[model samples]
Structure formats: C-alpha cells, structure tokens
Target: MARDNKAMISGFRCLCAFIFVISACSIASFLYSCQCTSPCHDPGREWGQSLTPNQTIDLLSFPEAWNNLNFPQVPPPWRMKIAVFVKKWPHRSQAGGLERHALTLHLELAKRGHEIHIFTTSPINASSFPKYPFPNLHFHLSKPTAAGYLDQSTVWDQFQAQNSSGSPRRPFDVVHTESVGLMHTRSRKLTNLAVSWHGIAYETIHSDIIQELLRSPEEPQAYSLTERAVKVVEEVKFFRSYAHHVATSDHVGDVLKRVYMIPEERVHVILNGVDEEIFRSDFKAGKNFRRNFGIPKSKTLVLGIAGRLVKDKGHPLMFEALKQMIRENAKFRETAIVLVAGDGPWGSRYRGLGSNNVLVLGPLEQAQLARFYNAIDIFINPTLRAQGLDHTLLEAMLCGKPVLATRLASITGSVIVNGNVGYTFPPTLELLKRALYRVWSDGRGVLEKKGEVARQRGLQFFSATKMAAAYERLFLCISSMSGGDTENQCQFEDSSR
Candidate 1:
C-alpha cells in the first residue's frame, strides 16, 4: 500500500510539472504581446511618466515626516472608485493577518472618502454578513466552494457586470487585488490593476525548506525540493500577468525584482500596518487584564505568542524552547508564564506542558487581542515562514511591548530595525533557548525600555495612517495615467526625500 501511494504521488508530481512547463510556454507569447501593447511599457507615455529623482525617492522610501511621531493625517487630494478583490472579509470570529490588513487599510481609505467596492467569497454563515461603520464601502459576495475558497470565476463575472452597468458606465479608477484576482488578471489584461502579494512562490519554496528541516525524522516530507522548484517556476510565470505589483515587505519587493525578474518600476513596497487607536499602550488595561486572568504581580516577565499554532508557524520550536526553559531554569518556572493565543493542532501539545506554565487563550477578537498584547511583557513569534510580515508583532509593539521573533528577512529588515526594539534568533532550538535566557536575565525593566522604542518605531512605520497614505499615493499615480483632471494628480511631494 505504501509503495502504491508513493508511486501515485510521483505520477501526480510529474503531471503537474508537465502542465507547468506547457503553461509557461503558452503564456510567453501573451506576456510579450502585453508588454509591446501596454501603455505602461512605453517610457514616453503618460502612465510611464519620468519621475524626478526626488519624486522617485519619495515614492520608494519611507518619508522623514513619519519619524515626527505626530505626523498629521493628510486626506487624499481626490476621491476615487476602487475595486478590491480579496478572498475573505474579516469577521470577529475569523480573521487572519491578510483579512485584518484588508479591513484596516480599506477602512482607512473609505474614511478618506474613496468609494470602495469589495469583491470576496461569501461568509461562513450565509445570514451573518459583517457590518462596518463606513458608509461608502460596499460588498459583492460570490458563493464559496464547500472548502470555503473563493469562486474566482463568479467574482470576476460580478466585477464585470458592476464595471459596465451604471447609466454612464462608471468604471473603477483602479483595481486592487489582495492576491485573489490572478485568474481574472490572467483572463484579461488591465493596465490599471495592481496586485498586492502577501507571499510569493519563491518565499513558499523557502518556507518548504525550513519546514522540512524542522520536521522530526519520524514524519514524512510533504513536498520534495524538486517539486517546490517546479512550482516556483510556474508561479513566477503567472506573476507576470499583472502589470503592477504591491509587495508587503522590503524583502518581498527585492525578491519580486531580482528573483522573479519583475521590473523595478512596477514593484512597490508598502509595509503592513496595525490600528494605532486600538493597540495603544495602556498600563491600567494591562494590569487589569493580568488581574482578571488571576496572574500574580510576582510574574515579572510574561511571554506571549499569538496567531495560529500550526507547526509551520514555528510552534514546534517555541514548544521545545519553552519546555527546556521551564525544566532547566527554576527562575523561569516561577517568574515567567507563556500565553498562547490563536487555535490549531499544537494548542493541546502546549497544554500538555502543564497549565501552570502555559496559558492557552485560544483565538481572540481584535479588542481582546489589544488586551492580550498589553498584558504581556514581550511578544514571541517563532514563525518559520518567511513570507509576509506578521501583524501580531506590530500590534504588540504598538501596545508598548517588545518582540522576540525569528531572524527572517521580513522581520529583521522591516519589523525589528534596531537591536533596542527586540531580540531575534535563528529558528533553531539552541538559539531560541539562548534568546529566551537573555530576555529572562534582562528582567522586566529592560524589556519596558525596549518596548518604548518599539512603540515609537511602530507608530512611525506600521500605523494605519501611513499605510493608507502610501497606498492612496500609488492609486492616484495609477489612476492619473488614464487622463483624470490635473487636480486629481498626486501633488503632495516630500522635500525630505
């Protein structure tokens, strides 16, 4: 039976590889035709306007005004009709990092008066659509599959009907896909469309390698290295279908440009952001939360790990490190307690460590997440996945808590810019143990100071306002190419650039 199963898996892989090669060859001509005919490809065209060196820098780099920490909200110069394509809308019960990002970013955009249309899969419960506070925001739901994935064809059909239905035929100024409109983009090319990539195939390949290395000898590998390499090639080819790309991290932007061969001008980096109002520092709230949970004041160093507890999230490493810390160091067993948030298979395993050592909080709503962040001394994200930036780290930082996370490029380059904000270690048992020990030795006072720095950094770079402004700027730039009024153009320039 085992031999037969192995043979079937091998056959499937071979079939997939063959299909990918054929698809790549088939799309080569289509991609070439797009480049030749697309206005975005012509350097002399309006969409391809030559930006001044300073304007180019401003578009690419983080603005200096953001460092002030009191940077005022600047409304967009003009409102727009934005079509958003995402897999799911965030609900109180079920919101992942991507869902939270879509909610935060588009809400801010809608608040600034953009007419937003969200096209997504139907809610889990048909009768319970999420209600938002924004007036101009509208939703178009496509029936989901049994497994809850989006029906891409239905979504695209809905978008087409809406795009051409109005009396004067109102068209969307710009189309934004949260990595869900690939099929539509592939079906027909649209110059004004921009796709935001949370994670790409190259990153997934790296994640696969990390997972395989971290897996126990008793476990079987999910995909061999060759299979992952084949998938990467397939993904990179498909990625070229979209004219513009939004990379969620600096590292991802670099990968899109260098590894996937996306043009530098077509790739934009906009780091993920959190809600500042909700995740702000509140000592009283933290104290109240600790008390409500019956945590004693003597527990000086409270460690937290949020998000899904699956093995790919690096929970195995965290479990091993925490277990070792509790067993070896008597001080940790007494002075520290680990709070595990979110739900997955590893929750029971964490509980097996004893309730006294690890407190399993399961999944939390946004408000509860704010309290959870404040109640802890430091946030630990031992994620092995090196794809998108994790929002929990930013949320914790916004709440004035330092982070101890894996030394992935996304975290190190974007999240933890300096050593003072937090600690980072390679995703290994020994290194993670050493990092935990160091945090233990530093005590709560040192962590508090680091948390303060982290708060400022989070406000400067990871605030919803900053993220919204950057995206609005990109939208304006893309929309202007289609001959909007001069007043609609992006006129705001940063001299500091």
Candidate 2:
C-alpha cells in the first residue's frame, strides 16, 4: 500500500511538470508574436517583419519621416489650446478610420507646436504600447464599458466641473468632438466647438437594410423596422445641431449639407490621409509576404481586402461573386486568390463560403498590413453602404497597389478615377466579376502602371500632413469668426506630466 501511494505521487509530479512546460511555451510564443523585431531582413521581402528598435526610434524622432504630408511653409507656428474628445482611440490590437484619423491629425498638430488634451476612453496600456514622448500632448483617460465604448458621463462630468467656478484650469480655446460624444452633452456652451463626423446614424440604418437584402434565404434579419426608424431620428437630431463640422470626404460634406441641412459654410471638407513614409512603394514585394499570411505564392493574381468582416462592408457580395466566378470562369478559378485581413462577427460565415483559395488573415498591425498590401496585385473595396472614406483604400493606394472599389460612395470615385488609379464598379456581383476579369486579363503591367498613378495621386492629395494642415486652417477660421484670438497661436502646457 505504501509503495502504491509513492507511485501515484510520482505520476502527479510528472503531469505537473508537463503542464508547466506547455504553459511556458505558450507564453513565450505569444511574447514573440508581439515583439517588435526584424523578422524579414531581405530588401525584396517587402511584406517581411522588419521592425527594429532603431527604426521605431527614427520614426519617432524624425519630423520629416513622421509628417511626410506636404504643406506650404507657415510663418512661426501658432499654438492653440485644443481639446480633442474621442469615444475610442486606436491601440495595438484595435483601430478603425475614426481612431486613425484622430491620431494622425493630432500627432501632426502636436508636432507643429499646438498643445492638445485628448479626452478618450481608449488609452494604450503602457506595457503593451510604450508611450512616446510628446511634450505638448496630454491624455485624459476615462473608464469605458466592457466592449470598449466610452462612458460619456465621465467626460461630461469632467468638462462641467472644469468649466464650473473655482476651477484652476483655464477654458479650452477649441473643442473638437468626434462621433456622437458632443451630442451626449447638453452644453454646446464652449467658446469654439467642432465635430469630426465619420458617419451618422442614418448611414448605419441604410447599411443594415442593404445587408438584410443581401442575406441568404435562411439567414435571419439583422435589424427591425422600429430600430431603423429610431436610429434615423436620433442621427438626424444629432446632426441638426449647429457647429463647425469636419467632413472626412466630399461625399460626407454633401451628406451634412443635404441630409442634415447643415449650412454650406459650416461644412469643412478635409479628406482623411495616409502616412506615406510607412506605406510606400519602396518595400520589395515577394513570396515572403504571402508566406507570412499563409497565402500560396504561386497564384497568378492575388487580390487583397481589409476591413471589418461585417454585413455592410460587402463581404457577402465578394463571396458570392467569387463563387460565381469559380463556377463560370475557368481561368479565374484556377489562377486567382483572395487574401482577406480583419476579423468580425461575420468571419465564420465568410469562411463558410468555402473557396479554398480565399484566405482570411485576422487583424494585423500597421507594419504587417504594409507587407500584406505589397504582396497583393489588386486591392478590392466592395463596401455597398457609403461610410464616408475608408483609410484602407488610401493605405493601399499609398503602398502603390491599385484599388477596385464601388462607385456608390462619394470618396471612392474622387480617389480612384477609372483606368487611372483603379477601376470602380457598381455594387453588383456581375459588375464586380467583369472588373476583376478585366484586371486579370490586362496582365501585371497594367496593374503596376495604375498602381504607380495611385501612389502619385495619394501623395499629392491624401498625405497626413495635408489633412492636419487643413484642420489647423479650419480651426483658425472658426476661431477668427468666434472673435476669440485672431492670431491663432497655440499655448503649450504640460498638464499630463
């Protein structure tokens, strides 16, 4: 009996040792994945992971590299006290158009000597994302919901208290609210108020209807009639309020003027921009990029698409079009492959489409994304519902990849002139297929030439520097009209320190 007990104890010890080893290995693998190190050393490995510590430091220190967006030289910089209110800010794992726009614009502004106070729910964890030193920039972090949405009450309470009597802090020169953060507040009593509108509630409802219509026979409806109506009313009511509005694209500006009945003068049309230094044609494209994403290198034509895998993003249309092509066109079926980046609720259904060639690479970091863009021959944006301008399209264009996007949106047509940067198709499987086939048959030379044009156009118009400068000019215009400070100079303060 004593010998039996000893044997059992020995077995338990061995099992515990095995478990410890497995856990250690898992932890190491995760750390390695998140580590910022050079993985692909070859210049030809454009999609290779080459994030060295030195490169990161250089990216941070070099103003020219960071602000590659071209702008006319200004006299001495004007410093303004700017309050930027955002519901969400980008982090390592999560980001969208709104976050990217806010970050890019604010960073450039900070570089230009403006003091910025960011009131946001999405604060980067210090362990995960090291906070870069920006002397004039301060973060007012607030607690958010489990799903990452901000608790607006915190922001409102802070603002009210700061504005209330007996407060030591001075009032902000200008307040720039993003999305519906300003809508939640009762007081538009601030000296100068501006909103960076990405999309209003009506566009969301419109997208839902399109998605439901595209659903399969057995698929359940995504929204109810009552919900749609309520959202429209809420959105219209929000937009109807008067303030200086920053529209991300020409299409969005029209929506503000026509749908919301905002005065034409109040609407500021500033197109969102890309960081040309990070996303450029200099990166060499090769099989390594494909291997990084588990994509086959030998495919004749590689197509890439990135965004949330949601109903409105037109993933359903893309899947259906690919299925039809596979059934009807033999050449496309054999030679073409689609590489998908990003993850969402509809991801499983997308994978269920079951084309062996369609590879879905879940969300990737910016560096990883640049590589992915280089690996692909063509970038596809089949977004049916107009959601202002998509940053991915600009990023792809900056990387010298031609985009085939839908013509429905106001921005896509403006950016992608047919036969110039890329071809735009109507939101239909037949139209999309034809465009795809046309590009495939036109061969690599046609795609490369169009991509070169795209790079030039992107640099000329959509640099982050240009977008930031436009916002600064708008701020000055609004400030001057308000009779506040005609000089439009920023006052730097190190409040966060």
Candidate 3:
C-alpha cells in the first residue's frame, strides 16, 4: 500500500508540470500577438480593436467637412445682442442659398457691431492657430453625434448640461433660429427666443425627391417604414412648434399663416438683402479671362448660371431651355454661349450631355465666380425645386446682369419692373427660353437696357447693409420684449395643417 501511494504522488507531480508549461506558453503568446475585439473587415470602425501590426490611423470624429464657410469678418459693434442657431457655422454648402444667406447675415450683423453668438457644428477648415477674433461675434461648437435621429437624445442632454454648467458665457439676449434639428427644433422656453422661419417646414418635407434621397445611402440606413412614421410624428410634435418666426418674404410669410396656420402676430416679414459691395465689382473682364473661359469679349451673348447643381435650384429647366434656345432661335447661332457654373451630384451628367454651346465649366470658388459674374451679360435662375428666394439672383442684379427667374421667386420683388428688369416665367422650358430671348435678344442694345434696369432695382432694395439694420431692430425688439404671446404661437402652429 505505501508503494502504491508513492506512485500516485509521482503522477500528480507530472500533471502539475504540464499545467505550468501550458500557462507560461499562453502568457508568451499574448505578449507577442494582441487580441482585437474588432474584426479586420469593418470599414467605419464600428468596433475598436488592437493589432500586432504597427499602423497609423486618422479618424473623423465629426462626419461633415463644414469648415469651408468662414465667419472671420469681425463686426465693429452694435447695441442688440443676438444669437443665431444653425446646424453648422462655417458650412461649405454656401451654394445652397440658405447657407450663403446665413453667412451674409452673420457678416453684416458682426460688421454692425451687434453682439452675435453663432451656435453651430465643429468647423473643419480654420487656421491651425485660431483667428477671426472679435468681441462682438462668438461661435460655439455644439456637441457632435455618433448616431443620427435617435442621437438627438444625447445632443439634448449635452446641450442641457452645457447650459447648466455656465462656462465662459452670459445669458443670450435673442435667439434667431433656422433649419431643422438641434436648437431650431427644440421647443425650450429659452426666454426671449425668436424663431426665424424661411417658410412652412411641411412644404419642404413632403417633396418626392427629398423623401427618396434620404434613403439613397450605400449602407443599410435602418430607414424602414417604422422609422419614417416616427420621423413624421416627431416633426409634427416638435419641429412645427415655435414661439415666433421671421419670414424672409411676404409670400413665405403668407404660407406660414395660411399653410402652417401660424398667427400674423407671430410671423414677421423680413426681406433678405444683397451685399452690393461683394457682388458688384469693376468686373472689367480680367486679361484673357473671357478667352480662357472660352468666350469673345465683344459680341458673344453670354448667359451665366451660378448656383448649386441640385435639381431644385432650377438647373433642369434651365438646361432644357438652353437646348430649346439653341435649336430654334436662329439669332442664338452667332452670339449665344451658355456658361453653367456650380457643382453638385448632377454635375457629371450635365457635362456628359456635352452640348457644345452649353459649357459646364465645373464650379468656381467665390473669387473665380465673381469673374464669371462679370463675364455674362444675362443671368438665369430656373429654381423650380426649392421655394425660397435666390440670393444668386440678387448677386446677378448687383453685377448689372439681366435675370430670368421663375414666378415663384416673386418673393425677391425685384425680378420685374413693369415686367422689364428681366422677366418672370414658369419652370417650363418654353417660358424660360422665350423670356431669355426677350431680355438678351442676341444683341448689345437690349442687354444694356435690361442690365441697367436690374442694377437700379438692386440698389433700390437689395442692399445688405439695409437688411442688417432691419435685423438690428428685430434683435433689439425681440431681446427686450418679455411675456411673448405663446398661446397664439401654439394656436397658429396647431391650426396650420
């Protein structure tokens, strides 16, 4: 029995040795090769991981590259304190009309010396060191979102926390709101908060293309039927509700009243102004510019288009109209040159059509755009897609160019002079072509007459400085006013089905 016990003990010792060797080997392998929670194939880093391979990686914490719009111009000083809430401050979609208008408002307000704080997304393309220093103007980067739609919960929590934290901040005097999502939609009391409305949000949300465009992503967007139903509910429940709104035009104001049922008292009509200084240049056809851009300086009847490549800003109608103009109008054969400028999804398709007369010269940076503005004697904005007025039309008029915009842009109130400062037409190509021919007539005499009328009309009403002054009064009144009629505001939103 003693000998048997000794044998069992020896066997136990061998088993122990084997276990020790296995544990040590495991430790050595772990030290050499890291175990990653994430797999190698994940494209957007949905999960974090570690690897044995020594690699450098760069990531975008914010998805949108929005720093292209610079709010650098320092405003001198003005009395009213104003806070404007936009999705992104230095956003690049300046061609999107609203973004450009927002920048123009910011600069004009800052120049006037009004205390302005712009709450926006993280700016992407600013100086590495930091500049655009001004006491009057301030820009705050809102919290970024990892998830969209449902991500608003996190955004709200962060905003509420920040507001409560009170870091390097004073109470906001007035808040001018725009767009969907974030502050614009958040129905907080935010005392003395003034909402800025371009028009009824419902008008835009119901468009067929916009509905389809939202789902046209490469990845599965989780955009099922239930999600869309929830979105519609949320829009109705939250977005349509506002304390007050400043509509940029009377037509839009009427829509707010008739369509959205917003009260007249709650809706204020404030026209957007064009900056004559920036749009109107000596524009003396810089040397070789007319030739380099493929045009004759003297006799060539140049028609310029400068806006987004979106189907909404009326590009399709304009293209079709140009086609009609060239095909039918004999006079266009000698003098007509269609210069379409700007960039978008439809850009390649526009270029691919390869109409010899229609030169899709890609997009022009603002400076380059100014030269093109000078190059053309006539301007066309066939914006059938969106409802708001075209700032480009204002720019064109300031450049002493005749414009042919749709009747929808009747909001500008500057498109016609006894039906003369250019002309108005429906989105139909027939109307657009007929109007274009009437204004330019493939002749210098008619172009000069129409151009002069356009410039005069622009000077009469579209000056940016004047608009800034209007906003100053608005800011002061809104900030100083207490006990706003919230009941009326709610009643209007509810009734405007």
For each candidate in the order shown, give its overall lDDT on alpha carbons: 0.79, 0.68, 0.56
User: Residues 1-497, candidate 2, lDDT per residue (tens digit)?
Assistant: 99999999986776565456445535754564466244311212321123322232221111111122223436135566777888777786488788888888898888888878887874555456336479878777787767676676787777665444223455566778877655544435654788887876545555665666667789876535445545555665766564767777655665565556676656766778877777777556535787765665457788898988876788778878887887787777677888888988766765765556687778988888888898888899889777767899998998888998877545443466456788888776788889888988987788989989888878766777767776776676566556565553222111211
> What TM-score would candidate 2 get against the native?
0.76
Better of 1 and 2 by lDDT: 1
- Name the lDDT of candidate 1: 0.79
Model 2 Cα shift for residue 239 (angstroms): 2.5
Stretches of candidate 1 exceeding 4 Å from the true structure: 1-72, 165-169, 182-188, 484-492
lDDT of 3: 0.56
RMSD of 2: 19.3
- Candidate 3 structure, TM-score to reference: 0.68
- For every model shown, what is its TM-score relative to the native structure? 0.85, 0.76, 0.68
**Counted clashes in each candidate structure:** 0, 5, 9
For model 1, how does the per-residue alpha-carbon lDDT over 68-171 read when each residue is reduced to its tens digit? 22223667556788898888888884787788889999999999999899988886587788787887899998887776767777877888888775546788
Better structure of 2 and 3 per lDDT? 2
Best candidate, lDDT: 1
Say which candidate scores most in TM-score. 1
